[model samples]
Target: MKYISGIIAILLLSVFAACEDETKTCDSTLLSDLGMNFKKDTLQGFLVKDTIWPKVTLYAIGNDSVLINRQPRSSAFMPLDPLHDTCRFYLQLDSIAIPDTLTFRYKRVPSFVSPGCGFATFFSLDTVITTYNTIDSIHINNREVNSSNDTHISLYFIY
Candidate 1:
């Protein structure tokens, strides 16, 4: 009975230790690789309001075709290629709206976190350009797209 109880206690301790170790992964990994805020410039930037369209879709501009569709969102935290200097996205407002391409130009810097946390990539926003179809303009509101959790870009849609 004593041996069994000792074994059980050790097993429990191991289980708890495993759970604690798993938490060592940095929370910065969950940070948005690129944060986007969709807004409508009421009176051409005098008053800006977050606009969530009912049928907006986002797709990665590559062969892998990562897609986020039919999501009504005012803001989004989308991932970008850590190794690539540029990230492009195809965005559509609705089924009938023309697909507009937004291209992000930036440089990725690898952050050396603790050994347990490993490393992460942070991007510095250089320029943002969008096709003037449904999108009116794109602005890099914040130049540093890092774990600071700030909106990196503001996208204005034609109102």
Candidate 2:
């Protein structure tokens, strides 16, 4: 009966182990990315090369306040509307240089990445418009935007 008791204890231990929670904390890649470059001429659906601008000023569209005074880099992840279908961004250097306004109309869908991460919104670009100030042009490189470490739009600055 000792062998039978050992087997029972092993089975009970296995059962407890199975009942333990196995889900991991959620962290999702769900942001839409944008890249900037200086374009000498306008091109439809243009892609950015290694031509990164020295400094591109960024602002918040809600309060019209400066977010990054001088973003000395490229590829910034844009915020998406989780409940709405529109998002906007403002870029103004100063009075010397004209400002640019970007408007994005997209389709938002709830993305449930994990239990820990919960739900986040994913966007599919329907249309993108820009105010041609110092910017030469803007184009949507990828319509299906997700958090995939990829660029969705390319902003071409007048060189």
Candidate 3:
């Protein structure tokens, strides 16, 4: 019984040591190679008494063909009501392919009531592509626009 207990304790210690070593392996080089980085902030705001409209589209240019489609994802819009101090929105890419460039197009429509104050906003679009060995590169694009009483459109790209 004593011998068996000792063997069990030794096995447990080995497993714990292996786990500790694994944690240290997450280095910056690995992150960079995988094209991973800390994400920046992008936000946009509009001040209007009525409703607002926003839309986004992403296109991918592959070696074979050109793909143009909607992101098929949901986004949040904050009305900036007096009760709520701030609003939040979340945007994400549906899918991404390797060795390809992506183009983004955005449009917004705003309506105002009393027009006491205009709206202020900022926003960002990011997509990450991964491979079997490592990430080739990370590309990020951002844009901001303010329209008090008219419609607006914005376009940009990331490669």
Scored by lDDT, the top model is: 1
Inter-residue clash pairs, candidate 2: 29-147
Query: Candidate 1 or 2, higher TM-score?
Result: 1
- In terms of lDDT, the poorest run of 10 residues in model 2 is 33-42
Residue 110: error of model 1 in Å?
0.9
lDDT of 3 by residue, 60-96 (tens): 2222322223333222221221222222222223333
Counted clashes in each candidate structure: 0, 1, 8
TM-score of 1: 0.76
lDDT tens readout by residue for model 2, 1-159: 769999999999999888756455445654544443344443444644545445667754775556567665554656665657887888764445777888889898677756666666667889888888777667677887666656677666645
- Candidate 2 deviant stretches above 4 angstroms: 1-22, 30-48, 64-66, 93-95
| Tens-place lDDT digits, model 1, residues 1-159 | 769999999999999877776445564454546888888988768988889877878887883665668777787766777768887888887778888898888888887654466767878888777898988888787888777778888888757
lDDT of each: 0.78, 0.66, 0.28
Instruction: Judging by TM-score against the true structure, name the best candidate.
Output: 1
Which is the better candidate, 2 or 3, if ranked by TM-score?
A: 2
Cα TM-score per model: 0.76, 0.68, 0.18
